[model samples]
Target: MGRIVRVISKDASVVCSAIDGKDIVSRIEEIHKTSAVVTAALGRLAMGTSLMGFGLKGKDDSITVKMDGDGPTGALICVSDSMGNVKAYVQNPVVELPLNDKGKLDVRGAVGSNGTLSVVKDMGLKEPYCGQVPIVSGEIAEDITNYLAVSEQVPSVCALGVLVNPDLTVNCAGGFLIQLLPFAPESAIDQIEKNINGMESVTKLICGGMTTEAIAMKALEGLEPNVLDDFEVNYRCNCSRERVENALISLGRAELEDLSKDGGTDVECHFCDKKYHFTPEEILGLIKE
Candidate 1:
């Protein structure tokens, strides 16, 4: 199973999370046949959401990651939870782009530099906690790092990457996040920054078969972190046929009757590329209950 590791760096006085999305990301790349741009974008989205999702305390808690981009890739959304379950989809998974000036996947060009990145945390409260920030860079990792620092007031460094082969298959995908603890010393912050700037590419590290815990330890070498927990992360979706039927029933009695006359209804889950078809009788039964 793919794993996510959380560690506390005693020297930097910070908490860090690293993920090797080997299994989950490979499966998604195979299923979507995503273009290079889409692969990079979705890969980063999955990594970022996984970090945030596992930060919650409750098993029932969940987090939603939404990026409304203005380029060919359109919008991207992902949902994840403390259990390390994540599901994500892109509005246009076929968007293609030439490599950027750096000779890398043109994620920014495909996602556009203008948009909003929002995170909603569902902590069993009636109202979810939401934080929104304007996209500083459509490069994903930077955008999310800014969102956490500016919007959430957490000093964080994020690195997310996807390596796609010429054959349009994923070679590797993963991410890492390092955050400073409250009132960390300036020297500690400087050392952490230096470590981040000197670090090797995250994708390369994962492709070399580095585990999540090893990555975290490598990144914070000078910090000497203590591993807190390790969790298995997978691509999981909560949508079901029953949930779709309940939604149709909630459309009201008139809508149910009209659907009965029309035969049935079709509903699609945005988080996963799954379609649920409901018969008129199913809708009526849901409404009666």
Candidate 2:
């Protein structure tokens, strides 16, 4: 499990959500067996969406982050509940790429610069709120900042990163997001800018054994920051046999019969490669509308 900490500046003009998601990211890598580059790419995206999830106000609220880039890794989708529980699907989890010019994992190469990053939030409303922004750098953090600025009209500072081991295991993964409320003063903005420019990297901080609380405090170095709340979340999937059967039933009785004539049904979950098999009679039993 990983922890998320919610912090508010002493003046309440700014708020931040900090996460230490190494454990959850490690679970994702194990489940997907992602290549080193894919591991870093998906790890950063998952951490970003997990922070978004922790920001939801409603208990049933959820958020989905989607990216379709012009790279070998294709599309990446991640879903998270209000509590920060998250699951993700990678279209190409085995993509291999050389290090970038700076000797860092080429996340931008795996996720090309051409595409869009879309965020949809279901706040238990009639329709979810949707926002989209063109991918600025395909480096997760920059794209998140662009989306918040252009689509939501919120001036935000975001830092997301993942450290991957040579064997493709995740060494550490985490992110922090801070937003300036409308009432934020000029001095506050200046202070934040200075702190952000002076702070250590989020991945470096996490790898050095900093907790989510410490990271949030570090981000709010100049401002009077207070820890408002904290909670833990993990990587988990909600797929089940009943859901698989319902999916088969949605295909129509004629199609079910046609498929049953050949063999049974094999349903596999994309988020967590859990497989479910049904016999011919079982597929026939799913004839209900």
Candidate 3:
């Protein structure tokens, strides 16, 4: 299980959230069989979504983040519940590219820049809240920061990272989100900026045995931070046979009848690749309901 720690400055002018998501990313990589670059890209998105979802006020609230880019990866999608459980998938898990000039995995090249980053928040309301912004860097972190600052009108700094081993296993994965609340003083903002500027990369800090709480403290070093909450999170797929059946029912009687002609059908979840089979009789039964 991964852990998340949320903190607020003593003056309540800023909030910082951090996650150590190695286990979550490892489970996702195992399920998706993603290439190095894709793992890094999706992992970063999942962690960022988890951090964002932690801010939801309702127990049942959830957030979905989607990146539709022109790169080979196609689209990367991550969903997180208020409790921090996350599930994610990429349109092309096998897509890979050569290392970039930085001699690192070319995440930006794989994610592409020509696209949009969209977020939807479901708070059990009549209509969910939606926001969208053009992809800024396709580097995941920068794009998330851009979305927060532009669409959400929150000045935030986001940093996400994933380190994949030579054998394609996750070594460490995590991220941090620091947001300046409205009416925040200039001194608080400057202190937060200085703290972030002097800190190491998230992955490096995790690799050095720093916990999420420590990361939050580092980001708010001079701000007298206080821990608000700490909790565990995981890459959890909520898909079930019942949910699949409900989805199939939503296709309408005509569609159900057509599907029943085939004797049976199989549905696979995009997030977890779990397959559910339904017999023709079952399909017809759903039609009667």
The TM-score leader among the candidates is: 3
Query: Residue by residue across 30-101, what tens digits does model 2's lDDT show?
Result: 999899988888888998999888889999899999988998999999999999999998999899888999
Task: TM-score winner between 1 and 2, please give it.
Answer: 2
Colliding pairs, model 3: none
lDDT for model 1, on a 0 to 1 scale? 0.83
Ranking by lDDT: 3, 2, 1
Off by over 4 Å in 1: none
Pairs that collide in candidate 2 are none
How well is each residue in 1-289 modelled by candidate 3, as lDDT tens digits? 8999999999999999999999999988999999999999999999999999999999999999999988999999999999889999899999869999999999999999989999999999999999999999999999999999999999999999999999999999999999999988999988987898899999899999999999998899999999999999999889999999999989999999999999899999999999999999988888755
TM-score of 3: 0.98
Residue 137 of model 3 has an lDDT of 97
Clashing pairs in 1: none
Better of 2 and 3 by TM-score: 3
Per-structure clash totals for the candidates: 0, 0, 0
Clashes of 1: 0
Sort the candidates on TM-score, descending order.
Answer: 3, 2, 1
